[model samples]
Target chain A: MNIIEVRNLCYAYEDDEPALDNVSLDIAAGKTTAVLGGNGAGKSTLFLNLNGVLTPKSGTMFFEGCQVTYGKKEMLELRRKIGIVFQDPDDQLFSASVTKDISFGLMKLGLTREDIQERVDRVVRQTGIGDLVSKPTHALSFGQKKRVAIAGVLVMQPSVIILDEPTAGLDPQGVSEILHLLQEIKDSMGITVIISTHEIDLVPLYCDDVIVLDKGRVVFSGTPAQLFAEPALLRAHNLRLPRINHLMNILHNKDHLAVDTSASTISTARASIKNLVSAKENI
Target chain B: MSGIDKYAYQSKLARVNAGTKLLFTLASMAVCLSFSSVLVSTLTIAVMSAATLILGGCRLRCYIRLLMIPFAFLVTGTITIIVGRISQPTQALVSIPLLGARYGVSADSLKTGVIIFLRAFGAVTCLYFFSLNTPMNSLLSLLRRKTPGLFVELMELCYRFIFVVWEEAGKIHTAQASRLGYDGFMRSLHSMGDLVTNVFLRVFRRVDRVTAALESRGFEGNFELLAEQEESSRLLEGLAIAATMFLIIIGLLERLLT
Candidate 1:
């Protein structure tokens, strides 16, 4: 099922050229979808449009099969169902305290105080930020602030959560930690997760589907395996195959081995290599 | 961390109710300012400083250093009060001839200066004691309850972004220094101009992004924040009230005696 559908989306900032031009894609429900693009590829703009933060110049968006409207009530309802975590945590976090920041969204929902507390507590535990709830947002580290930012959205219990470059500027451990939390969020809540990133390697490991954007257009939309298989197409868009897929390509082309070039993850590549070795032994 | 922020987080009274601290600070400041007797002023300074250092667990050296900030201002102000034109040479305890005028320190002028100086220092100490023990977040939360929502909202944003702007400025300064942007006076001036312009641009962009993020989370025209869990102790409140009464009593007794 499609949680969010963008059809012929076109957006321009002020008098500038279109940031998103005739872009269309369907984000699958209850799955992790990765939006891949380089700088100025309109990933952020698309996320904003989906949440009604920006109205497209000429396009239509459907949330759960209903065409989105620009009415104030309709926009608020859409925002309640769709939350966007900005690329910079500093931009997203307005409250000084972590608990208060997380509670901001719930307050908008007009939930009872007890319900708000319960939701905030659940997200704090889910994000593993129980200790930081009382701490000021300014005191948090970059990684911790990112968690708080995610928690702020997660507390709203949006069915579809969109993140703009969620793992940008994180250390290796921080990236893994955020990805792990996202995975947990997906499995436990079954919420549709959409993230935009240039980290080609993380897409295969974490995302189920891939949407490739280039020059403000949807160049490719498919599963990670299907997307990685077209290495030449990806290269033309200023993107490269994941490290494992690149290695598999080298093995097939230079080493003359029948390796699976479609394998994008380490474990998949390992299995493919084992199969190649066993086939050679049998021959 | 900034100096006040560091102590505020570590202060033993940090967990105390912000209302109690605010009330105590204001009441003490009122007494300190209202009293003209030197004894009441001296007592106010001593009591507030001790409460901050001993009860609030602020370091003595830090408290004394903060006191010196107001002390310097008080000295400059009190100089005029201490020095007077001697109408009677007999009244001059010490006299100096400057620019064909005789400037002298009289016994009466000395007493007035000392009293005013102590009163000003005492009022400042009360404020320092309150700020040192209560974190800005706590104070803001307290204000949110008592003050207008818009005022509190503006204060919250300003407080959070001040740190952001300071950090951005620091990063720009370091980047400039590494590239020898500050090697010469002229270069340093040029670098400063660039830094200011870049910081403003960055902060402007950040504000726009922050607005989008806020909207995504369902922000309407006004900001609604969660109330912090306040720790209120009746025993503490009683002790604070008693202390304020004691200070007031001292001030009254001094007034009666002097």
Candidate 2:
């Protein structure tokens, strides 16, 4: 079932220029979806729309089969179901203390003190920030602050969590750690995880589905395999195929090697190469 | 400011109830300011310093350094009060003719300046003790419970964004420095101007993003503050109240004696 579905959604910061134009997409429940776009490509606008942070000019957002209303009570209910972790951790984490920041959303939900504490504790453990609960937010490294930002949203127990460029400023290892954590969240809690990023390389590694946005329009919405299969289309949108997929395409198109061009990761490329070698050997 | 913040989080008294610390600090400040006796002000300073150093676990060196910041101002302020205009030579303890006017230090003026200086310094010490022991989050939590909603919300936002703006300014300064932007005096001035402009723009952008993020978390008009840990202890609360009353009584007694 689709947890969130946006139809004909259009938004504009200025009157003449639209940030999102006639965009439609579905985020499946209990799945990881990656929104792919370059800067100013309306990825953030789409995420904001999904979370009801931006009201679209001419579209309807359906949450669990009901059209989202902009009324105070309805918006609050929508926001409780869809939590957003912004691109900047500094912007998202407003509290001085880690535990306090993580409990902000839960407190807004009007949970009991004990309930909020339990949720904060659980999120701290889950996010591997056990040592940082009492630490001031300003003392944390960028990666640690990012984890706190994620934990802040997670503690609210949203059914659909939207992250804007979750690994934008993270180191290589930090990137993988965040992706692995997101995977764990999807598996354990059955959450609908949606992240918008320009990191094509990370999509195939962690995401089950992909939505490609270009110039405020949805150019492609399908599995990563389907998206990567059309490299020309991705290039038209100012994106490239994942690195491994590009190398595989080179082997297939230039070297005349019988390898899967859809291989988007090193492990997949390795398996495809092994298959090619065995096939040649059998011949 | 950052140093005090760091020490505050690491203070041994950080987990104590903020209300108790606030009550003690404010009451001590009030007593120090009200009493005209030097002994009362001296005792107030000593008690606050001891609390900060012993109970709060603030290093002696750090406390002295923090004290020095206000001492410079106090000395200049007191100097103005001590230097008086004397109409007669007999009234002047030490007189100097400056621009055809007699500027002198009288005994009465000297005594008044000393008392004022000590009182101001003692009040500062009381504030330092409270700030060094209680984290800003705890203070904000307390304020959220007591103050008007709008006032508390403004304070919360300001306190949270100050660090953000500081970090952003630091990043911009470093970026400029790496490019030889501060290699010369003129270049340094130019870079500083550019840095301020860029930081302002970035801060404005961040404010928009932060507002959207808050809305995403269901923040309506009010900022939802987190529930702080209940740190109230009957013994500690009673001791704090008693100490404040004791200080007030001392101030009263010292006034009577004088």
Residue B6, model 1: lDDT of: 76
Q: Would you give me the overall lDDT of model 2?
A: 0.87
lDDT of 1 at B43: 82
lDDT of 2 by residue, B1-258 (tens): 379998999898887889889888888898888876798889888888988999788999999998999999999999999998977767789999998889999888889999999999999999998999998888888888878988877777788789889888998899999999999999999999999899889988888888898888888776666667857767656766776777788878766776
Q: What are the per-model numbers of colliding residue pairs?
A: 0, 0
- How close to the true structure is residue A204 of candidate 2, measured as C-alpha lDDT? 93
TM-score top scorer: 1
- DockQ of candidate 1 (2 decimals): 0.72
Residue A151 lDDT (model 2): 91
Model 1 segments beyond 4 Å from truth? A278-283, B97-101, B255-258
Q: Once model 2 is optimally superposed onto the true structure by TM-score, how far is the C-alpha of residue B213 displaced, in angstroms?
A: 1.7
Judged by DockQ cut-offs, the docking class of candidate 1 is medium
Q: For every candidate structure, what is the RMSD over all alpha carbons to the true structure, in angstroms?
A: 1.9, 3.2
* lDDT for model 1: 0.89
Best by DockQ: 1
Q: For residues A1-283, could you state the per-residue lDDT of candidate 1 as single tens digits?
A: 9988889999999999889999999999999999998999988988889999999999898999999999999999899889888888989888777888888867767678888888888899999998887677778899999999999998888899999998999999999999999999899999999999989998989999999999899999999989888888998999998988899999999999899888888899999999988988999
